[model samples]
Target: MSDLSRLSLNQATIKYAGMEQAVSACLRAEIPGIGLWREPVAEYGLRKTGALLRQAGLTPTSMCRGGFFTSPDSDQRIKDLADNRAAVDECAELGVPELVLVSGGLPDGSRDVDGARSMVLDSLAELAPYAGERGVRLAIEPLHPMFCSDRCVVATLGQALDLASRFPAEQVGVVVDTYHIWWDPTVYQAIERAEGRISAFQVCDWITPLPAGVLLGRGMMGDGCIELRRMREAVDKAGYTGPIEVEIFNQEIWDADAMEIAELTAARYVEHVL
Candidate 1:
């Protein structure tokens, strides 16, 4: 088991578990890392969550999210900026290294993909300094193209690398997730370009023949066709030795016990990828 200690379980993998219970599972599984979501932290209270992680001796690989930078309404844009600033504060408070960002999709009534992307770039330019000042690197996660219209504007590793190039290495970077970007043709090349700027690496298997409007269909490792070992090799080659965070969001997994999910994920990584 090549030190499954480096495996982190993103809390969404066990959404049925309470924040504290999830911590218990991670601790029991000997997982050294975790990735928390803003809502769960808010629900459990950030200070309390941080204390829980500390008690469990777990460090967060990165916060689950903090970037929804595209909106048609100027007011909404300002709101997103304010929200991300608060996210930065939360990440700093927890002593986490990175804030994962899912640059949001096009504004209402707008289909101009380029314009939406520009908005995301401008928003990051404005927010990166704040995050940097607080010692939090913003990790721009490129969602799958399936989410291009409604969930995220950034949809490829190549595009995310391009976005990171606009900011300082300490301030901005890319997060590679097999579930979201494995199908990208230039994925491996993009990872090489990422190099030191690969702020985070997430894992989740991909299931084909997805249904319409499906927002949470992430499969577990070895349960789907994703070549996680190859992806991990790519990440290691890209110079990122960070935790491989399992971030499954499937209904079946989310409804199961947290400890079971964490254990299974860790075992799979050790057996197939490590």
Candidate 2:
């Protein structure tokens, strides 16, 4: 089995860094895989971003996101689909393995989580084929239940696996991020059930006593209560031998030097997860 030493850096950890700057930091630290966000790509231009990453010999792990299937109006839904199509093209251009899908939450003026989930699946059913033709696997990343209202509706590993089961193994997968799923009662068994459908495994510690209306305050590994070693074991047991990507969205980390943050994140993941 491969050790958990191969940790990838998700750019959100250092959101203050520009595209070229982040790529340079990862390259300097010899990190192998990176996850890119759309805003930075738009700011730096897709062709330039891809060329620079290639020059630096970095692998684009997965696009930051491309799923928001819970909008009330058909107009918004069409817009989201268009935006997702553009994201898919970017992934194909960068040769990224998967497009992380954080299926969106309840629609406006509605409280129907199930209906929103249905919308997500329906969108995936349509988009997966197009993405497959481009050699980009769609990875469903189930957000924590705390985000069930506005961020993502799929809130468990089993829920994600069930969605993936609707498609072929190669066409669809899931991102098992510890921060979002650690509280799940069935996480271990669900990972076992995930089998080969686990495409990306992200790590981050979840902080408690969150301030009101604060959506993102992820702590670094070992800073919060998440059992990093156990989460790694679950993914490994499920036969997912991919690089464990560290995705911390902390405001404090963002204010630090990009290189230092990347190095510290790598060290922490290795320290706690191995």
Candidate 3:
């Protein structure tokens, strides 16, 4: 299985499974790691989630998100920053070190991409020290350009790195998700530039004929066109030796048997990512 030791099944990959069920699936597959999300963690109870992962011997890789820092309203910005601080506290309690961030897109009726990006930077400047104090790193994850309008504004790895470079590497970093950046022509160079800033290395394929709500269109490791292994090698070459999370978001996979999906994910990861 090409050493499934470093493989992590992100909870979103099996969206139907609750936290306990997800842990059980990981155990059955002998997967050593798991990437947790905030909602499920809250549902399971933070202290209880920590206890369960510790008991099950599964490592908490990274948290799903802690951003949305593109608000133009000062009140909304305050709320977002508070929520992020809580997210950082949650990560510290759960023993997860990386908190992935998706920079929010334009505010209502606003089209200034440059201005939205500036808001992201300013918000990060406010949260970075708070996160660093809690021993958590804010990993800026630039979504694909398709998501630039609503979900994220940082569209490239270089751009994500530019934002990360503004803060201490221990405080702010970047997530290199294969499905999002594999199509970028200068991805390798960006990875090189991201040496110390690569906080998380996520893997998932990009499927064709994207489903509605494109957020759920991610494919299994070998099911699409992304060069999973090359991306892995590039991240490795950049010195990020952390858990490789399989964070796919697809309705079909979510509807399948959780354990079987996990097994298939592991096998495909071995075949395609390693």
Candidate 4:
């Protein structure tokens, strides 16, 4: 097997491609697994996408998401819980062992970061058991601190691990994405602390002059200052032996040919992350 056997293409890295095309790109690039998003999977029909992965011999390493429990409104919180349950069910159907969670930010007009994080804990306390019953691990992903107010309140690997520790390791875990936590001074220590709680590991470099919304500014591997290989080694040392997913969310990368992007991603993974 090639060294890239553990490399998985995250569909968001090639958001322009359809599910079939993205899986095809992974196959053509000889990648063994894929990290899928819920939107396209639902659009293609969950059962159909599951069948496609089976036929193509592609492993669904992790599902994109299933969390947004920071809302203050009771109705909104109920809706978020319902949606996350559905996502858990879909994860079971897709045979993906892990469902990535991007816990929502503080509710509108609210400045309570601690309260929002507590909400996340409460939400996970409810959903983790449901996911565990279905054999799907909830992988809590910590977005960068810059997104603390808008995207995710969980801003560090330590925070993610702390939240995940509330549940059984098999049911809840943390995702150590290089793009988000590379700048942290205590990241390596957190990785060691995570140990068996890492469910998925994602790679994307960080770049300057973030875009208007700061959502599409992820740099491709090796294009920025993140020590991709160092982070990978840290996760490995933490006892994680799963797919290393590439999840870049940039418009320029999306504009490129999907196959080219896959090929280049493979090369970069070898150069910078292996």
Residue pairs that clash (backbone atoms under 3 angstroms), model 3: none
TM-score of each: 0.97, 0.95, 0.98, 0.98
**RMSD, model 3, all Cα superposed?**
0.8
Query: For candidate 3, what is the lDDT?
Result: 0.93
Model 3 worst lDDT run, 10 consecutive residues? 1-10
Model 2 agreement with the true structure over 5-60: per-residue lDDT tens digits: 46688888889899988988887776887888878988999999889988888878
Instruction: Please report, in order, the local distance difference test score of every candidate based on alpha carbons.
Output: 0.88, 0.86, 0.93, 0.93
lDDT of 1 by residue, 30-106 (tens): 88898889899999999999898888889888897888888878998899899999999999999988999999987
What ranges in model 4 sit over 4 Å off? none
Clashing pairs in 4: none
Misplaced by over 4 Å in model 2 are: 1-5
- TM-score comparison, 1 vs 4, better candidate: 4
Location of the lowest summed lDDT over 10 successive residues in candidate 1: 208-217
How many pairs collide in each candidate, listed in order? 0, 0, 0, 0
Return whichever of 1 and 3 wins on TM-score: 3
